[model samples]
Every structure is written in C-alpha cells, then in structure tokens.
Target: MHLNRFDDLAADVSRGLARRTSRRSFTSKVGVWLFGAVAAPLLLPVARGRAEDRYAGEEGDPRSCDYWRYCATNGYLCECCGGSANECPPGTTMSALSWIGTCRNPADGKNYLISYNDCCGTAQCNRCSCSRHESETPVYRAGTANDIHWCSANESTAINCTVAVVLGAAEDEV
Candidate 1:
C-alpha cells in the first residue's frame, strides 16, 4: 500500500512538471547550458588574439610570435615592451625560474635551448600578445610547459612580458 502511494505521488509530480514546461523549452534550456559550459572556458585565458603570421626561412621578426626563439612561449613579447627578446624591460626583473623550449634558429638551422623567462613587477604588458604551442607539455611536467605563470618566485608576481633567452645550441641525440 505504501509503495502504491509513493508511485501515485511520483506520477502526479511528473504530470505537473510536464504541464508546466514543453519539450522544446526544456531542450532549448539544456542546449543553452551545455553551450555555456563548453565555450566559456576558452574565453577565460588572460591573453586573447591571433598569433602573428609565421615568416618563411630566417626572415621572421622577433616582435612577432612566429620568431624562432619563441617556439614554446605563451606570453607577451618583451620586444614590444621596450625590451629586446633576450632582456627584460627597464623596471621589471626576469624570474629566475623559466620554462624551457627547444627551437630551431632559422638563421643557424640548429636547435637551441630557449629559456622563456617572465619579467615580474608591473601589470602585464598587453602588447604583442601571442602564444606559440610548439612542443608544449602537460602541466604536470611544469618545467617543459609554457602556459603557466613563471613569475611566481619573484618579489612581485605581476608579469609584464616574457623574454626568450637562448641558453645554447642543443646537441643531437644518439
């Protein structure tokens, strides 16, 4: 008898819900929620913009994202913020810790170890923003990943720009 009573109550609740909303309305609401869940995260990154066009051979500009040294970089270029590719801006200091990348210099045709260091101090330099995902690694392998804030170890964690310093040419593996 108790089971029968619970079933009748459940049927009444379902009938009321069905009367209150149409199938089209329910599906449209679900679709909107699903779209928001999927697409919202893509817009959350701090940087937004298309990467600069890649140049052929050794002619690419350092200020652009397609430059040889920035093969795995994912931040604003220091070259656009009153600094060269290998140096931090005037006031900001380069973080000691850096994410590493191996990039082939178009001019030399040799792979070099590029240390992507972040300049910390002021707010982010919103200029020349670009992200090159070449040889990107998972976040678990933090040393090889470029999509993280590398300025966290400094006095001021505010990242201004990133400089890709060439450590040395990478030796060929046997």
Candidate 2:
C-alpha cells in the first residue's frame, strides 16, 4: 500500500476535525459560565492590584540627576523645576508622547522600563545632567531613541525638557 503526502494530510485533517467536533459538544455555554464562576475567585487576587505597583522603587534622590531611576534617562530633570522625579512641573503638561528606556533599578538591581516624557509648555530645566544610555539608539530609530526631542506632538516648538517616569519593570520572557 502506497500513500502520498496529500493522503496523509487529508487523514490528519479529518482526525483533527473529528476531535474538534467531539470536544466542541462538551464546551457549552453553561460549562463556560460554570468554569468562569469557579476560576474568578482563584484569579481575583492576582488581577486586583495595579500592575504599575510591581515596579515601584524607593531609591534615588529626585534632586540629583544620576539617581538610580535615571539609569537610562536622557533629558532635563523635572526636579530642577517644581516637579518631582516622576512628575511634570507645575503649569506644564506632561506629553503623552514619550521614549522608552530600560533603566536599572538600584533598589532591586533589575532593569525597569522608564518612560521619558517631555514636559511641554515650559522652558528647559538645565540643572541636572543625568544622561544614562542603556538601550538608547540614534534619532533615525526614534522608538527606542531618547536623544530625540519627543515634545513635537504636544508643543508647537522644540522640547524644553524631559522627565523620567517609571512605567514598569521589564518582565522576563518565559
């Protein structure tokens, strides 16, 4: 008996369809609802808290630019103005546009994802000189590049300064 590739494929597809049809009958609407009711309680605690809290850090001084949170930071310090380490200055709007930087957190010694958002409608705060480049790239590749001015979308003119805000820690790949 000689069997071709197409014959083997057809037999495999037929077996798959038979198994799917059999399995489909077992998963009814009532079964799905019952599964959710039983699983929701077990999963609630894992999903209840804010995901951002997992990357919270208590290290680094806001006044200094070379603080631990500013490991991969590239911009003017918000602390120089009225803003703290993770906030925009008063009267200045934090631009939704930002660059992602993988900064090393000294507290936990892990790389955290930091969003360097530009504070619009304000002059540049030239106090701190924190320019830690970890995975920074050139202006042509603006997605991961922190050197480029990221305030063009919010403000009409050039970017005044930038603020390093912790978005979250980098999760390990499974």
Candidate 3:
C-alpha cells in the first residue's frame, strides 16, 4: 500500500514537471529568447535548404554564383562559357540574345540583328557585366589580326518564335 502511494506521488510530480516545462518553452526567457529572436532571420532560410545548393557548379569557375549556389533574391557574381564573349571564336556572339521583330537600330531606323552578351570571360572582356557596351575604337589593338568583342545588353535578334518555331524565348525589347 505504501509503495503504491509513493508511485502515485511520483507519477503526479512527473506530470506536473512535464506540463511546466512545455508551458515554459514559449515564455520570454531573458538571454536565450532574446538571442534566438535576434538570430531567427539568419537561421530560417538555412534551416529550409540542404547543403548541396551552395556548391553546385564549383568545378567551373569556383566563384560563379547561380540559383543553386546562393540564397534566393540575393545577387552574386557568376561565370559563363568562354573567354571574352564578343571575342569568342568565329561563330559565338558576345551578347545575350532575345528575340526581336527584325532587329532595329536605336541610333538610326536601320534594322540589324544582335543579342545580349550575357557572359564574357576572355582577353576581350566581353562578359555580361553590370554595364555592357563597346567603344568604336578598340582599347587594345596590338596586332592587325586581333579578334575581340564587347558584351552588349542592348543587342537583339529578329528571330520570331511564332513563325519559325525554334528554340529561344519570344522577342524581348530593351
């Protein structure tokens, strides 16, 4: 009988402590609660994602930043396919290209095709960058056979998606 009474008392005490602990979890504890509040923003996103996203394409230009490597909405530097974009071999272009209806010239009415140099990484410095443009005169024309190009964001193409039905997004103006 005495042993049963002791057991009952022990169980009651255990239940009370459990209830108190649960209730206390949400309370405003001084150092711990305030520290957690301060650290929440930094921890929330990290808790949501796994570790692979941070180093997806590290093999190619380890510094390059992309969707998988950096946090969403945060901007970071990224690498592209080659040396300076415009200076790419013969067929490559140094600009990112979007479809335009028969590319038109902003300086004059004459239409010509072009694309955006979304990337550049070579002697030419034609990488898609914060500002993309080329001066009429080459900055470093060392020899007569020099090949170079500049990354241009304003460039566009005349390829119409509805008509040709090929790859690439619809014409984007800008």
Best-performing candidate as measured by TM-score? 1
Model 2 CA RMSD to the hidden true structure, in angstroms? 20.0
Q: Give a tens-digit lDDT track for model 1, residues 1-174.
A: 377754453344333333222223333233324333543354223112433334334445677565678788877889899888889999999899999888888676888888999999998898777576677798999888987887878879999999998888889721
Best of the two (1, 3) by TM-score: 1
Tens digit per residue, CA lDDT, model 3, 68-148: 111110111223323221123333333443221222332233333323222322233222222212211232531111122
Q: Which ranges of candidate 3 are over 4 A from the true structure? A: 1-37, 40-49, 53-154, 157-174
What lDDT, from 0 to 1, does candidate 2 have?
Answer: 0.60
lDDT of 2 by residue, 112-166 (tens): 7878888888676665645656688887878778766667777444445667887
Q: How would you order the candidates by TM-score, starting with the best? A: 1, 2, 3
Local lDDT at 128 for model 2? 60
TM-score of each: 0.65, 0.61, 0.16
lDDT of 3: 0.26
On the 0 to 100 scale, the lDDT of residue 144 in model 1 is 84
Alpha-carbon shift of residue 69 in model 1 (angstroms)? 0.7
RMSD of 3: 23.8
Model 2 spans > 4 angstroms off: 1-56
